[model samples]
Target: MIKHNVISVVLGGGKGSRLYPLTHQRSKPAVPIAGKYRLVDIPISNCLNSGYNRIFVLTQYNSASLNSHIKNTYNFSVFSKGFVEILAAEQTNEGERWYQGTADAVRHLQRYLQHHDYEHLLILSGDQLYQIDFQEMIEAHIETGAEISVATIPVNAKDATSFGILKSDEAGNITSFIEKPNSSLLPPWESEVNDEMKAVGRVYLASMGIYVFNKSILTQILEESEGVDFGKELLPEAIGRYKIHSYQYPGYWTDIGNIDSFFEANIGLTDDIPQFNLFDRNTIFSRARMLPPSKVSGTTLDNVVIADGCIVAAERIERSVIGIRSRIGVGSVIKTTYMMGSDFYQTLHEIEDARANGFPLVGVGENCYIENAILDKSCCIGDNVRITGGAHLADGDFDTHAIRDGIVVVKKRAILPAGTVIG
Candidate 1:
């Protein structure tokens, strides 16, 4: 039992199409980020920090990575009564259809939800990065008696067209909702960037993709919908009916849907003035000292955010993120890269012209020298390998390996032998 009126549900079962190659072998929520952490860690960690226990993670697609990560990383077993459960869509009496949409995913879990006496059901996507107090949002929802209270973020006008824009009234009550509306078709409140947008504020309220639903209303909507999505089906249908309140969470949040977004979000952590603070004491996000401190000895590191348990040699690492216990070989020069400290080998092994998909890109110097390249997790770089060529690119295929235009994706645990070159 949650002991409270709220139970958090993390929707971890989306087929991440935007993160194609990375999701080729794993789910999007399981994709590695900031070197050592996965995409699911963002919301789960947020839940833990927000003081919301009794969580249920719904998963589809390739979920082995997600399952392993949940088991190994979060320490879910310690909870005597409060537990985190993963509900994978199995062949039931109905049929074995993959999750159709977000609404459908939740609808499938109605059995468990129906049994709970909680007043509110908090639904969250497991792939976003943010640190906001959900307890505050829950309080607001209860105070307003809203049918559905959504968490919203104000995105720049240029980015508004890409999201499911929510047009709300002066009282935080949603008025009009549009899913990825065009510049010309927007409301007058949304401002246009290139003399086109019909809306003002470029400051339209969109879903952080998170929601707090009154359990009764949520059940009613799901029962009516049978199987539908929040963005595509539910929200569109819920307009002008019930109290669909929007809980504005104005904070640092990013939906890591692509390589560029993922890479940039990770690099943002190294900024002198970071927009998103992951280590804030506000208790908006939880803290876990699972790993030891990062080790930097014979290396010269300048302007880098290094995570726990790392071994750095006499290598020069600058403007890069090193994850837990990662090994930096002697004489290796790393720059403008993000490496997950937890996934690296302690020894300088034979690596290939590879990547950790979107993870610690094992960069090697020219002699041992590498420049401006990304290495994925467990990628073996030979004794001497170079991922040279700092050419500006957007999205293209590199023969067998697909680069997101400019980004070089290294697959997990790939081994590149000595004397190799990757462009």
Candidate 2:
């Protein structure tokens, strides 16, 4: 069975500098998305739904929150030989350093991996949004007898440069591979573009960073090569020496590798029918929390997703994803924003004391006008605050917020003074 043969490893990314402030308190994988679930849940859920239960998450930087979330969320029955475990970077007889890159992270865990009985290792990115059945890819790998199988998708030229490009022969065997190729160096498109692709314009094959490797071949490659990363090092080297194949996935997939992409992916959920459907009863899975239903009073909401325990008294809110336990004051207008909401609710006494001390509680305040922005968890915005991501800022780092792809990001637990204006 696929469950007995495949061991899934989800890579928790390195110090997520691009997703700062959000990554400030939690690891990139632990960062919340779509109101309630964490980013790491995607890959783990996919593996589980696809009949693969043995999963190991590799993490190093800011892993406290990530570890907690995993511990609290994923628990398998002992009767079944299935478990989701965290393999943190540790000092051992083999090495004394942290994970250097993707390959190195897996290489360091070779000792533990050797103890597990499996035929293939499924490598996945922790911060991507998509639903895939790994069984299909596994079957393709077995059918082709491939030493390594890489999952790929068609991407336009504008987005191709951000991913590793690949060229495959008629049999779907990868002939060439390049990491983040320059536009000038990209090979011409050899495959025909379907009508759906034609509507989006020219397209090229791009790696999804999802790989399935034969256990023996993987062990051999890690031991023989000094490559630290898969995309930048190991994969390109394996193109000619090994039986490298490609599996094309024609579904919605987005890599949340940076702030701009993360912002867009979350906001995109407000669509009438999103490309990535969280409401699907069959595919997606995450931590299930038990809390009172969200309460909204005198608020005008449109295309919004309000999570559990949220209290909203705003005048108008449009196209927003409000997380659990969020509080919005009266007369406030939230448009095109993601409020991560709070981890825990403030006690009545704490709110009263904060009010007496002239400090705003952890939420949006009265008459605030916010648009195209991300308010991280537990942030306090005082009365009459206005935040608009209207400026064409490619990138910026400020005291109160950072601007990425024209979206204003207020850091986690940040406090803003009353009547503050940010653009």
- Number of clashes recorded per candidate: 44, 0
lDDT, residue 124, candidate 1 = 91
Q: Which whole-number lDDT from 0 to 100 does residue 136 have in model 1?
A: 83
Candidate 2's residue-wise lDDT over 133-239, tens digit each? 89999999999989999999988888888998888998999998888978887657435556797578646888999999999999999988999999999999998
Clashes by residue pair, model 2: none
Alpha carbon lDDT at 83, candidate 1: 64
The deviation in Å at residue 55 for candidate 2 is: 0.5
Please provide TM-scores, in order, for all candidate models, with all chains considered together: 0.86, 0.97
lDDT, model 1, position 139: 81
Error of 2 at 349 (Å): 1.5
* lDDT of the candidates, in the order given: 0.71, 0.90
How many clashes would you count in candidate 2? Answer: 0
Worst 10 residues of 2 by lDDT: 185-194
